[model samples]
Target: MAGVRQFDEDSAFEQALEVFRAKGYRATSMLDLAKSTGVQRGSLYNAYGDKEEIFSRVFERYADRFVADARVALNKAGLREALVEFFVFAIRSITQGSPARGCLSTKIAVEIASESPRQQELVKKMLDELEDVLVGVLQSPEARAQLVIPPRQAARIIVTMTRGIAVMERVYSDPKRLRQTASALIDTMVRPG
Candidate 1:
Protein backbone atom coordinates (compact mmCIF):
# COMPACT_ATOMS: atom_id res chain seq x y z
CA MET A 1 0.00 0.00 0.00
CA ALA A 2 1.10 3.56 -0.53
CA GLY A 3 2.02 5.76 2.44
CA VAL A 4 -0.89 7.30 4.27
CA ARG A 5 -1.58 10.97 3.67
CA GLN A 6 -0.66 13.08 6.69
CA PHE A 7 -3.05 16.00 6.00
CA ASP A 8 -6.69 15.58 5.13
CA GLU A 9 -8.46 17.78 2.58
CA ASP A 10 -10.45 19.91 5.05
CA SER A 11 -7.46 20.54 7.28
CA ALA A 12 -5.32 21.37 4.28
CA PHE A 13 -7.95 23.71 2.95
CA GLU A 14 -8.30 25.54 6.27
CA GLN A 15 -4.56 26.10 6.50
CA ALA A 16 -4.41 27.22 2.89
CA LEU A 17 -7.31 29.60 3.58
CA GLU A 18 -5.45 31.17 6.47
CA VAL A 19 -2.53 31.87 4.18
CA PHE A 20 -4.78 33.28 1.50
CA ARG A 21 -6.59 35.51 4.03
CA ALA A 22 -3.29 36.81 5.36
CA LYS A 23 -1.42 37.34 2.09
CA GLY A 24 -4.26 37.46 -0.45
CA TYR A 25 -4.56 35.59 -3.77
CA ARG A 26 -1.81 37.14 -5.90
CA ALA A 27 0.79 37.34 -3.16
CA THR A 28 0.33 33.80 -1.80
CA SER A 29 2.92 31.55 -3.45
CA MET A 30 2.91 27.78 -3.79
CA LEU A 31 5.67 27.56 -1.23
CA ASP A 32 3.58 29.59 1.21
CA LEU A 33 0.68 27.20 0.67
CA ALA A 34 2.92 24.21 1.21
CA LYS A 35 4.28 25.65 4.43
CA SER A 36 0.84 26.67 5.67
CA THR A 37 -0.74 23.32 4.81
CA GLY A 38 2.20 21.35 6.23
CA VAL A 39 2.36 19.31 3.05
CA GLN A 40 5.00 18.89 0.42
CA ARG A 41 4.64 20.85 -2.79
CA GLY A 42 4.14 17.67 -4.78
CA SER A 43 1.36 16.48 -2.49
CA LEU A 44 -0.31 19.89 -2.58
CA TYR A 45 -0.20 19.84 -6.37
CA ASN A 46 -1.57 16.30 -6.38
CA ALA A 47 -4.42 17.21 -4.06
CA TYR A 48 -5.32 20.73 -5.21
CA GLY A 49 -4.01 20.75 -8.81
CA ASP A 50 -2.60 24.29 -8.49
CA LYS A 51 -2.59 27.49 -6.48
CA GLU A 52 -5.47 28.92 -8.50
CA GLU A 53 -7.62 25.88 -7.78
CA ILE A 54 -6.85 26.12 -4.08
CA PHE A 55 -7.65 29.85 -4.08
CA SER A 56 -10.96 29.20 -5.82
CA ARG A 57 -11.94 26.64 -3.19
CA VAL A 58 -10.98 28.98 -0.35
CA PHE A 59 -12.94 31.82 -1.92
CA GLU A 60 -16.02 29.62 -2.24
CA ARG A 61 -15.81 28.65 1.40
CA TYR A 62 -15.38 32.24 2.54
CA ALA A 63 -18.25 33.49 0.39
CA ASP A 64 -20.54 30.72 1.52
CA ARG A 65 -19.86 31.38 5.20
CA PHE A 66 -20.41 35.11 4.79
CA VAL A 67 -23.67 34.60 2.94
CA ALA A 68 -24.84 32.10 5.51
CA ASP A 69 -24.22 34.53 8.35
CA ALA A 70 -25.97 37.32 6.48
CA ARG A 71 -28.99 35.08 5.92
CA VAL A 72 -29.21 34.34 9.62
CA ALA A 73 -28.97 38.02 10.45
CA LEU A 74 -31.69 38.80 7.94
CA ASN A 75 -34.02 36.35 9.63
CA LYS A 76 -33.63 38.08 12.98
CA ALA A 77 -36.39 40.25 14.51
CA GLY A 78 -36.20 43.55 12.57
CA LEU A 79 -34.65 44.64 9.30
CA ARG A 80 -32.83 47.53 10.95
CA GLU A 81 -31.47 45.29 13.67
CA ALA A 82 -30.34 42.76 11.12
CA LEU A 83 -28.58 45.44 9.11
CA VAL A 84 -26.87 46.73 12.21
CA GLU A 85 -25.76 43.23 13.12
CA PHE A 86 -24.38 42.69 9.65
CA PHE A 87 -22.39 45.91 9.69
CA VAL A 88 -21.24 45.36 13.25
CA PHE A 89 -20.02 41.88 12.38
CA ALA A 90 -18.22 43.21 9.32
CA ILE A 91 -16.55 46.06 11.19
CA ARG A 92 -15.44 43.81 14.03
CA SER A 93 -14.15 41.25 11.56
CA ILE A 94 -12.05 43.71 9.61
CA THR A 95 -10.81 45.76 12.54
CA GLN A 96 -9.99 43.24 15.25
CA GLY A 97 -9.63 39.95 13.45
CA SER A 98 -6.53 37.81 13.44
CA PRO A 99 -5.46 39.11 10.06
CA ALA A 100 -6.80 42.62 10.77
CA ARG A 101 -7.42 43.58 7.10
CA GLY A 102 -10.26 44.07 4.63
CA CYS A 103 -12.20 41.39 2.77
CA LEU A 104 -10.44 38.82 0.59
CA SER A 105 -12.92 39.27 -2.25
CA THR A 106 -12.55 43.05 -2.08
CA LYS A 107 -8.77 42.71 -2.05
CA ILE A 108 -8.91 40.41 -5.07
CA ALA A 109 -11.29 42.77 -6.82
CA VAL A 110 -8.60 45.46 -6.75
CA GLU A 111 -5.92 43.18 -8.18
CA ILE A 112 -7.95 41.25 -10.76
CA ALA A 113 -7.16 42.40 -14.29
CA SER A 114 -9.79 43.44 -16.80
CA GLU A 115 -8.29 40.90 -19.18
CA SER A 116 -9.24 38.12 -16.75
CA PRO A 117 -12.85 38.00 -17.85
CA ARG A 118 -13.66 34.96 -15.76
CA GLN A 119 -12.47 36.53 -12.50
CA GLN A 120 -14.26 39.75 -13.30
CA GLU A 121 -17.48 37.85 -13.98
CA LEU A 122 -17.12 35.90 -10.75
CA VAL A 123 -16.69 39.10 -8.74
CA LYS A 124 -19.71 40.68 -10.35
CA LYS A 125 -21.79 37.59 -9.66
CA MET A 126 -20.71 37.58 -6.03
CA LEU A 127 -21.63 41.24 -5.57
CA ASP A 128 -24.95 40.70 -7.35
CA GLU A 129 -25.85 37.83 -5.08
CA LEU A 130 -25.06 39.89 -2.02
CA GLU A 131 -27.22 42.71 -3.34
CA ASP A 132 -30.06 40.28 -4.01
CA VAL A 133 -29.99 39.10 -0.41
CA LEU A 134 -30.05 42.63 0.93
CA VAL A 135 -32.93 43.55 -1.36
CA GLY A 136 -34.86 40.56 -0.15
CA VAL A 137 -34.55 41.89 3.39
CA LEU A 138 -35.42 45.47 2.46
CA GLN A 139 -38.66 44.53 0.72
CA SER A 140 -40.38 47.88 0.64
CA PRO A 141 -42.49 48.23 -2.48
CA GLU A 142 -43.62 51.72 -1.48
CA ALA A 143 -40.09 52.94 -0.98
CA ARG A 144 -39.06 51.45 -4.30
CA ALA A 145 -41.79 53.43 -6.05
CA GLN A 146 -40.98 56.61 -4.17
CA LEU A 147 -37.23 56.43 -4.73
CA VAL A 148 -37.54 55.30 -8.37
CA ILE A 149 -34.47 53.17 -7.78
CA PRO A 150 -34.80 49.43 -8.01
CA PRO A 151 -34.39 47.38 -4.87
CA ARG A 152 -31.31 45.89 -6.47
CA GLN A 153 -29.63 49.27 -6.68
CA ALA A 154 -30.56 50.12 -3.11
CA ALA A 155 -29.16 46.80 -1.95
CA ARG A 156 -25.93 47.50 -3.81
CA ILE A 157 -25.61 50.78 -1.99
CA ILE A 158 -26.04 49.07 1.37
CA VAL A 159 -23.45 46.44 0.56
CA THR A 160 -21.07 49.07 -0.76
CA MET A 161 -21.46 51.10 2.41
CA THR A 162 -20.74 48.08 4.57
CA ARG A 163 -17.64 47.26 2.53
CA GLY A 164 -16.48 50.85 2.76
CA ILE A 165 -16.96 50.81 6.51
CA ALA A 166 -14.88 47.67 6.78
CA VAL A 167 -12.06 49.30 4.81
CA MET A 168 -12.23 52.34 7.05
CA GLU A 169 -12.13 50.19 10.17
CA ARG A 170 -8.97 48.57 8.87
CA VAL A 171 -7.36 51.99 8.91
CA TYR A 172 -9.00 53.34 12.07
CA SER A 173 -9.38 51.29 15.24
CA ASP A 174 -11.91 53.40 17.12
CA PRO A 175 -14.81 51.05 17.86
CA LYS A 176 -17.05 53.89 18.97
CA ARG A 177 -16.56 55.68 15.66
CA LEU A 178 -17.21 52.52 13.69
CA ARG A 179 -20.33 51.77 15.69
CA GLN A 180 -21.58 55.34 15.23
CA THR A 181 -21.01 55.12 11.48
CA ALA A 182 -22.86 51.81 11.29
CA SER A 183 -25.72 53.26 13.33
CA ALA A 184 -25.95 56.29 11.07
CA LEU A 185 -25.93 54.15 7.96
CA ILE A 186 -28.70 51.89 9.22
CA ASP A 187 -30.73 54.90 10.32
CA THR A 188 -30.40 56.56 6.94
CA MET A 189 -31.39 53.43 5.05
CA VAL A 190 -34.32 52.57 7.29
CA ARG A 191 -35.72 55.98 8.18
CA PRO A 192 -34.36 57.95 5.23
CA GLY A 193 -34.83 61.69 5.69
Candidate 2:
Protein backbone atom coordinates (compact mmCIF):
# COMPACT_ATOMS: atom_id res chain seq x y z
CA MET A 1 0.00 0.00 0.00
CA ALA A 2 1.93 2.96 -1.27
CA GLY A 3 -0.46 5.76 -0.17
CA VAL A 4 -2.81 4.33 2.39
CA ARG A 5 -3.92 6.95 4.92
CA GLN A 6 -2.20 6.66 8.28
CA PHE A 7 -4.80 8.67 10.25
CA ASP A 8 -8.46 8.04 10.98
CA GLU A 9 -10.50 9.46 8.13
CA ASP A 10 -13.80 9.43 10.08
CA SER A 11 -12.34 11.22 13.06
CA ALA A 12 -10.71 13.83 10.84
CA PHE A 13 -14.00 14.53 9.08
CA GLU A 14 -15.82 14.83 12.41
CA GLN A 15 -13.25 17.35 13.62
CA ALA A 16 -13.41 19.25 10.36
CA LEU A 17 -17.20 19.37 10.75
CA GLU A 18 -16.83 20.83 14.25
CA VAL A 19 -14.41 23.47 12.95
CA PHE A 20 -16.73 24.42 10.14
CA ARG A 21 -19.73 24.50 12.46
CA ALA A 22 -17.89 26.72 14.93
CA LYS A 23 -16.23 29.08 12.43
CA GLY A 24 -18.35 28.77 9.27
CA TYR A 25 -16.90 27.86 5.91
CA ARG A 26 -15.09 31.04 4.87
CA ALA A 27 -13.67 31.69 8.32
CA THR A 28 -12.29 28.15 8.59
CA SER A 29 -8.92 27.66 6.91
CA MET A 30 -6.94 24.58 5.96
CA LEU A 31 -4.72 25.06 8.97
CA ASP A 32 -7.74 25.27 11.25
CA LEU A 33 -9.05 22.04 9.84
CA ALA A 34 -5.68 20.37 10.17
CA LYS A 35 -5.19 21.48 13.77
CA SER A 36 -8.73 20.54 14.70
CA THR A 37 -8.51 17.16 13.02
CA GLY A 38 -4.95 16.36 14.12
CA VAL A 39 -4.18 15.76 10.48
CA GLN A 40 -1.20 17.29 8.71
CA ARG A 41 -2.10 20.03 6.27
CA GLY A 42 -0.22 18.31 3.47
CA SER A 43 -1.91 15.04 4.25
CA LEU A 44 -5.33 16.72 4.33
CA TYR A 45 -4.72 18.29 0.97
CA ASN A 46 -3.51 15.02 -0.42
CA ALA A 47 -6.35 12.95 1.07
CA TYR A 48 -9.23 15.37 0.59
CA GLY A 49 -8.09 17.87 -2.01
CA ASP A 50 -8.79 21.33 -0.48
CA LYS A 51 -10.93 23.01 2.13
CA GLU A 52 -13.98 23.12 -0.10
CA GLU A 53 -13.64 19.46 -1.00
CA ILE A 54 -13.37 18.47 2.63
CA PHE A 55 -16.35 20.63 3.50
CA SER A 56 -18.40 19.08 0.75
CA ARG A 57 -17.70 15.63 2.09
CA VAL A 58 -18.55 16.64 5.63
CA PHE A 59 -21.68 18.54 4.58
CA GLU A 60 -23.00 15.57 2.63
CA ARG A 61 -22.71 13.35 5.67
CA TYR A 62 -24.35 15.94 7.89
CA ALA A 63 -27.19 16.55 5.47
CA ASP A 64 -27.98 12.87 5.29
CA ARG A 65 -27.95 12.43 9.06
CA PHE A 66 -30.05 15.55 9.61
CA VAL A 67 -32.79 14.42 7.26
CA ALA A 68 -32.73 10.89 8.67
CA ASP A 69 -33.08 12.26 12.18
CA ALA A 70 -35.98 14.43 11.08
CA ARG A 71 -37.76 11.40 9.72
CA VAL A 72 -37.21 9.57 12.98
CA ALA A 73 -38.42 12.44 15.10
CA LEU A 74 -41.49 12.95 12.96
CA ASN A 75 -42.49 9.31 13.28
CA LYS A 76 -43.66 9.44 16.88
CA ALA A 77 -47.03 8.12 18.07
CA GLY A 78 -49.06 11.35 18.01
CA LEU A 79 -48.95 14.53 15.95
CA ARG A 80 -48.08 16.80 18.84
CA GLU A 81 -45.50 14.40 20.11
CA ALA A 82 -44.01 14.03 16.66
CA LEU A 83 -43.66 17.74 16.01
CA VAL A 84 -42.52 18.40 19.57
CA GLU A 85 -39.93 15.67 19.36
CA PHE A 86 -38.77 17.00 16.01
CA PHE A 87 -38.18 20.45 17.47
CA VAL A 88 -36.56 18.93 20.53
CA PHE A 89 -34.28 16.98 18.23
CA ALA A 90 -33.51 20.17 16.33
CA ILE A 91 -32.85 22.18 19.50
CA ARG A 92 -30.56 19.49 20.83
CA SER A 93 -28.69 19.51 17.53
CA ILE A 94 -27.93 23.23 17.58
CA THR A 95 -27.14 23.31 21.30
CA GLN A 96 -24.53 20.57 21.26
CA GLY A 97 -21.40 22.60 22.24
CA SER A 98 -20.78 25.25 24.93
CA PRO A 99 -22.05 28.38 23.17
CA ALA A 100 -24.32 26.62 20.71
CA ARG A 101 -23.30 26.37 17.06
CA GLY A 102 -26.82 26.56 15.57
CA CYS A 103 -27.79 24.59 12.48
CA LEU A 104 -24.76 24.01 10.32
CA SER A 105 -26.74 23.87 7.09
CA THR A 106 -28.71 26.98 7.96
CA LYS A 107 -25.54 28.77 9.06
CA ILE A 108 -23.73 27.74 5.92
CA ALA A 109 -26.69 28.84 3.82
CA VAL A 110 -26.49 32.31 5.26
CA GLU A 111 -22.69 32.37 5.44
CA ILE A 112 -22.21 31.37 1.79
CA ALA A 113 -24.96 33.48 0.35
CA SER A 114 -23.60 35.37 -2.70
CA GLU A 115 -20.49 33.18 -2.54
CA SER A 116 -20.77 29.70 -4.01
CA PRO A 117 -23.70 28.51 -6.10
CA ARG A 118 -22.71 24.90 -5.46
CA GLN A 119 -22.87 25.33 -1.70
CA GLN A 120 -26.10 27.26 -2.00
CA GLU A 121 -27.62 24.44 -3.99
CA LEU A 122 -26.45 21.92 -1.45
CA VAL A 123 -28.11 23.80 1.36
CA LYS A 124 -31.31 24.27 -0.62
CA LYS A 125 -31.50 20.59 -1.40
CA MET A 126 -31.11 19.66 2.24
CA LEU A 127 -33.86 22.10 3.23
CA ASP A 128 -36.18 20.78 0.56
CA GLU A 129 -35.59 17.24 1.81
CA LEU A 130 -36.43 18.32 5.34
CA GLU A 131 -39.58 20.06 4.19
CA ASP A 132 -40.62 16.97 2.32
CA VAL A 133 -40.19 14.91 5.44
CA LEU A 134 -42.34 17.34 7.35
CA VAL A 135 -44.98 17.17 4.68
CA GLY A 136 -45.02 13.40 4.91
CA VAL A 137 -45.51 13.57 8.63
CA LEU A 138 -48.24 16.15 8.34
CA GLN A 139 -50.05 14.10 5.74
CA SER A 140 -49.97 10.95 7.81
CA PRO A 141 -53.36 9.69 8.93
CA GLU A 142 -52.54 10.33 12.58
CA ALA A 143 -51.48 13.88 11.82
CA ARG A 144 -54.06 14.75 9.18
CA ALA A 145 -56.94 14.68 11.67
CA GLN A 146 -55.39 17.42 13.75
CA LEU A 147 -54.17 19.64 10.96
CA VAL A 148 -55.65 23.12 10.76
CA ILE A 149 -54.13 23.90 7.38
CA PRO A 150 -52.95 22.13 4.28
CA PRO A 151 -50.08 19.75 4.86
CA ARG A 152 -47.77 21.59 2.46
CA GLN A 153 -48.47 24.92 4.12
CA ALA A 154 -47.97 23.42 7.56
CA ALA A 155 -44.75 21.81 6.44
CA ARG A 156 -43.42 25.15 5.22
CA ILE A 157 -44.35 26.71 8.53
CA ILE A 158 -42.54 23.97 10.39
CA VAL A 159 -39.47 24.42 8.19
CA THR A 160 -39.43 28.17 8.73
CA MET A 161 -39.96 27.79 12.45
CA THR A 162 -37.21 25.18 12.64
CA ARG A 163 -34.77 27.58 11.01
CA GLY A 164 -35.85 30.34 13.33
CA ILE A 165 -35.33 28.06 16.32
CA ALA A 166 -31.79 27.39 15.13
CA VAL A 167 -31.06 31.12 14.93
CA MET A 168 -32.66 31.75 18.30
CA GLU A 169 -30.68 28.95 19.88
CA ARG A 170 -27.55 30.88 19.00
CA VAL A 171 -29.04 34.14 20.20
CA TYR A 172 -30.49 32.86 23.47
CA SER A 173 -28.87 29.44 23.99
CA ASP A 174 -31.75 28.53 26.31
CA PRO A 175 -33.27 25.10 25.74
CA LYS A 176 -36.28 25.82 27.96
CA ARG A 177 -37.31 28.85 25.91
CA LEU A 178 -36.85 26.84 22.73
CA ARG A 179 -39.05 24.06 24.09
CA GLN A 180 -41.74 26.55 25.02
CA THR A 181 -41.59 28.01 21.55
CA ALA A 182 -41.94 24.53 20.06
CA SER A 183 -44.96 23.86 22.22
CA ALA A 184 -46.58 27.11 21.16
CA LEU A 185 -45.88 26.32 17.53
CA ILE A 186 -47.49 22.91 17.89
CA ASP A 187 -50.55 24.47 19.50
CA THR A 188 -50.94 27.12 16.84
CA MET A 189 -50.26 24.89 13.89
CA VAL A 190 -52.13 21.73 14.80
CA ARG A 191 -55.37 22.73 16.48
CA PRO A 192 -58.26 20.43 15.56
CA GLY A 193 -60.85 21.95 13.25
Candidate 3:
Protein backbone atom coordinates (compact mmCIF):
# COMPACT_ATOMS: atom_id res chain seq x y z
CA MET A 1 0.00 0.00 0.00
CA ALA A 2 2.90 2.37 0.54
CA GLY A 3 3.89 2.27 -3.13
CA VAL A 4 0.36 2.38 -4.54
CA ARG A 5 -0.46 5.59 -6.46
CA GLN A 6 -3.56 7.49 -5.36
CA PHE A 7 -4.41 8.80 -8.83
CA ASP A 8 -6.00 7.10 -11.84
CA GLU A 9 -3.22 6.13 -14.24
CA ASP A 10 -5.50 5.92 -17.30
CA SER A 11 -7.08 9.30 -16.63
CA ALA A 12 -3.69 10.90 -16.18
CA PHE A 13 -2.50 9.35 -19.42
CA GLU A 14 -5.53 10.73 -21.26
CA GLN A 15 -4.89 14.18 -19.87
CA ALA A 16 -1.22 13.99 -20.80
CA LEU A 17 -2.24 12.79 -24.27
CA GLU A 18 -4.35 15.90 -24.76
CA VAL A 19 -1.40 18.09 -23.89
CA PHE A 20 0.92 16.19 -26.18
CA ARG A 21 -1.60 16.33 -29.01
CA ALA A 22 -1.96 20.08 -28.65
CA LYS A 23 1.70 21.03 -28.14
CA GLY A 24 3.56 18.13 -29.83
CA TYR A 25 6.52 16.14 -28.51
CA ARG A 26 9.21 18.81 -28.93
CA ALA A 27 7.18 21.50 -27.22
CA THR A 28 5.67 19.44 -24.39
CA SER A 29 7.56 19.26 -21.09
CA MET A 30 7.20 17.06 -18.03
CA LEU A 31 5.85 20.01 -16.06
CA ASP A 32 3.17 20.50 -18.70
CA LEU A 33 2.19 16.83 -18.57
CA ALA A 34 2.04 16.90 -14.79
CA LYS A 35 -0.01 20.08 -14.71
CA SER A 36 -2.44 18.93 -17.36
CA THR A 37 -2.70 15.53 -15.71
CA GLY A 38 -3.25 17.17 -12.28
CA VAL A 39 -0.62 14.92 -10.76
CA GLN A 40 2.52 16.05 -8.95
CA ARG A 41 5.64 16.17 -11.11
CA GLY A 42 7.47 13.73 -8.87
CA SER A 43 4.48 11.41 -8.86
CA LEU A 44 4.29 11.51 -12.63
CA TYR A 45 7.96 10.68 -13.03
CA ASN A 46 7.68 7.88 -10.50
CA ALA A 47 4.54 6.46 -12.07
CA TYR A 48 5.41 6.79 -15.76
CA GLY A 49 9.14 7.30 -15.87
CA ASP A 50 10.29 10.27 -18.04
CA LYS A 51 8.40 12.18 -20.71
CA GLU A 52 9.60 9.85 -23.48
CA GLU A 53 8.48 6.75 -21.63
CA ILE A 54 5.12 8.31 -20.85
CA PHE A 55 4.74 9.28 -24.50
CA SER A 56 5.61 5.81 -25.72
CA ARG A 57 2.99 4.22 -23.51
CA VAL A 58 0.39 6.85 -24.36
CA PHE A 59 1.11 6.52 -28.09
CA GLU A 60 0.80 2.74 -27.99
CA ARG A 61 -2.60 3.05 -26.37
CA TYR A 62 -3.74 5.63 -28.90
CA ALA A 63 -2.53 3.57 -31.86
CA ASP A 64 -4.25 0.44 -30.59
CA ARG A 65 -7.58 2.20 -30.15
CA PHE A 66 -7.24 3.86 -33.54
CA VAL A 67 -6.66 0.55 -35.31
CA ALA A 68 -9.55 -1.09 -33.51
CA ASP A 69 -11.82 1.75 -34.57
CA ALA A 70 -10.63 1.40 -38.15
CA ARG A 71 -11.52 -2.27 -38.05
CA VAL A 72 -15.03 -1.40 -36.94
CA ALA A 73 -15.46 1.23 -39.63
CA LEU A 74 -14.37 -1.14 -42.35
CA ASN A 75 -16.97 -3.69 -41.35
CA LYS A 76 -19.81 -2.24 -43.40
CA ALA A 77 -22.15 -4.32 -45.59
CA GLY A 78 -20.33 -3.23 -48.72
CA LEU A 79 -16.89 -2.11 -49.75
CA ARG A 80 -17.98 1.39 -50.73
CA GLU A 81 -19.94 1.81 -47.56
CA ALA A 82 -17.06 0.44 -45.51
CA LEU A 83 -14.53 2.75 -47.14
CA VAL A 84 -16.83 5.72 -46.54
CA GLU A 85 -17.19 4.77 -42.93
CA PHE A 86 -13.44 4.36 -42.60
CA PHE A 87 -12.76 7.80 -44.09
CA VAL A 88 -15.41 9.34 -41.91
CA PHE A 89 -13.76 7.82 -38.86
CA ALA A 90 -10.35 9.09 -39.98
CA ILE A 91 -11.74 12.59 -40.63
CA ARG A 92 -13.36 12.80 -37.24
CA SER A 93 -10.08 11.94 -35.56
CA ILE A 94 -8.29 14.93 -37.09
CA THR A 95 -11.17 17.42 -36.81
CA GLN A 96 -12.51 16.57 -33.39
CA GLY A 97 -11.98 19.89 -31.61
CA SER A 98 -11.45 23.60 -32.24
CA PRO A 99 -8.14 24.36 -34.03
CA ALA A 100 -7.96 20.62 -34.90
CA ARG A 101 -5.36 18.45 -33.20
CA GLY A 102 -4.66 16.45 -36.39
CA CYS A 103 -3.24 12.93 -36.20
CA LEU A 104 -0.75 12.38 -33.37
CA SER A 105 1.01 9.70 -35.38
CA THR A 106 1.32 12.02 -38.36
CA LYS A 107 2.55 14.80 -36.13
CA ILE A 108 5.08 12.44 -34.58
CA ALA A 109 6.22 11.17 -37.96
CA VAL A 110 6.87 14.64 -39.30
CA GLU A 111 8.11 16.36 -36.16
CA ILE A 112 10.27 13.81 -34.39
CA ALA A 113 10.67 10.89 -36.78
CA SER A 114 14.25 11.76 -37.63
CA GLU A 115 15.26 12.80 -34.16
CA SER A 116 14.09 9.65 -32.34
CA PRO A 117 14.33 6.21 -33.84
CA ARG A 118 12.09 4.66 -31.21
CA GLN A 119 9.39 7.24 -31.84
CA GLN A 120 9.84 6.81 -35.58
CA GLU A 121 9.35 3.04 -35.26
CA LEU A 122 6.21 3.59 -33.27
CA VAL A 123 4.75 5.75 -36.01
CA LYS A 124 5.80 3.29 -38.67
CA LYS A 125 4.26 0.40 -36.76
CA MET A 126 1.02 2.27 -36.34
CA LEU A 127 0.85 3.03 -40.04
CA ASP A 128 1.68 -0.56 -40.88
CA GLU A 129 -1.08 -1.78 -38.60
CA LEU A 130 -3.54 0.58 -40.25
CA GLU A 131 -2.48 -0.60 -43.70
CA ASP A 132 -2.86 -4.20 -42.65
CA VAL A 133 -6.40 -3.51 -41.49
CA LEU A 134 -7.23 -1.81 -44.77
CA VAL A 135 -5.72 -4.65 -46.72
CA GLY A 136 -7.82 -7.16 -44.87
CA VAL A 137 -10.95 -5.26 -45.77
CA LEU A 138 -9.88 -4.66 -49.33
CA GLN A 139 -9.06 -8.28 -49.93
CA SER A 140 -12.53 -9.41 -49.03
CA PRO A 141 -14.59 -10.73 -51.94
CA GLU A 142 -16.85 -7.70 -52.07
CA ALA A 143 -13.97 -5.24 -51.77
CA ARG A 144 -11.77 -7.06 -54.25
CA ALA A 145 -14.55 -7.04 -56.83
CA GLN A 146 -15.02 -3.32 -56.39
CA LEU A 147 -11.40 -2.28 -56.17
CA VAL A 148 -9.66 -1.05 -59.33
CA ILE A 149 -6.18 -1.79 -57.98
CA PRO A 150 -4.64 -4.64 -56.01
CA PRO A 151 -5.61 -4.83 -52.36
CA ARG A 152 -2.11 -4.09 -51.08
CA GLN A 153 -1.68 -1.08 -53.36
CA ALA A 154 -5.11 0.23 -52.58
CA ALA A 155 -4.47 -0.19 -48.88
CA ARG A 156 -1.23 1.76 -49.12
CA ILE A 157 -2.92 4.52 -51.09
CA ILE A 158 -5.71 4.79 -48.57
CA VAL A 159 -3.21 5.03 -45.73
CA THR A 160 -1.19 7.67 -47.59
CA MET A 161 -4.29 9.66 -48.45
CA THR A 162 -5.45 9.52 -44.87
CA ARG A 163 -2.18 11.14 -43.83
CA GLY A 164 -2.74 13.81 -46.45
CA ILE A 165 -6.23 14.37 -45.11
CA ALA A 166 -4.76 14.82 -41.64
CA VAL A 167 -2.51 17.63 -42.93
CA MET A 168 -5.33 19.20 -44.95
CA GLU A 169 -7.66 19.08 -41.97
CA ARG A 170 -5.24 21.34 -40.08
CA VAL A 171 -4.81 23.70 -43.02
CA TYR A 172 -8.48 24.02 -43.96
CA SER A 173 -10.19 22.91 -40.78
CA ASP A 174 -13.15 22.03 -43.01
CA PRO A 175 -14.65 18.60 -42.53
CA LYS A 176 -16.77 18.94 -45.64
CA ARG A 177 -13.73 19.61 -47.81
CA LEU A 178 -11.94 16.65 -46.32
CA ARG A 179 -14.98 14.43 -46.85
CA GLN A 180 -15.28 15.54 -50.43
CA THR A 181 -11.62 14.77 -51.03
CA ALA A 182 -12.01 11.33 -49.51
CA SER A 183 -15.08 10.66 -51.61
CA ALA A 184 -13.21 11.62 -54.74
CA LEU A 185 -10.33 9.38 -53.85
CA ILE A 186 -12.72 6.54 -53.22
CA ASP A 187 -14.46 7.18 -56.52
CA THR A 188 -11.15 7.02 -58.38
CA MET A 189 -9.79 3.96 -56.63
CA VAL A 190 -12.96 1.92 -56.17
CA ARG A 191 -15.41 0.97 -58.85
CA PRO A 192 -19.05 1.92 -58.31
CA GLY A 193 -20.33 -1.58 -58.97
TM-score for all models, in order of appearance: 0.84, 0.93, 0.97
* Model 3 regions lying over 4 Å from their true place: none
lDDT of 2 by residue, 1-33 (tens): 648998998898899999999899999999999
Q: Tell me how far the alpha carbon of residue 132 in candidate 1 is from the true structure, in angstroms, after superposition.
A: 1.4
**Quick one: best lDDT, which candidate?**
3
Tens digits of per-residue lDDT, candidate 1, 88-136, equal: 7766666656557567767777776364676666667677778788887
lDDT of each: 0.73, 0.88, 0.93
Report the error of model 2 at residue 7, Å: 2.3
Off by over 4 Å in 1: 1-6, 113-115, 140-150
User: Who is ahead in lDDT, 2 or 3?
Assistant: 3
Residue 131 accuracy (lDDT) in model 3: 99
TM-score of 3: 0.97
- After TM-score superposition, the amount by which residue 26's alpha carbon in candidate 2 deviates from its true location, in angstroms, is 1.2
RMSD of 3: 1.0
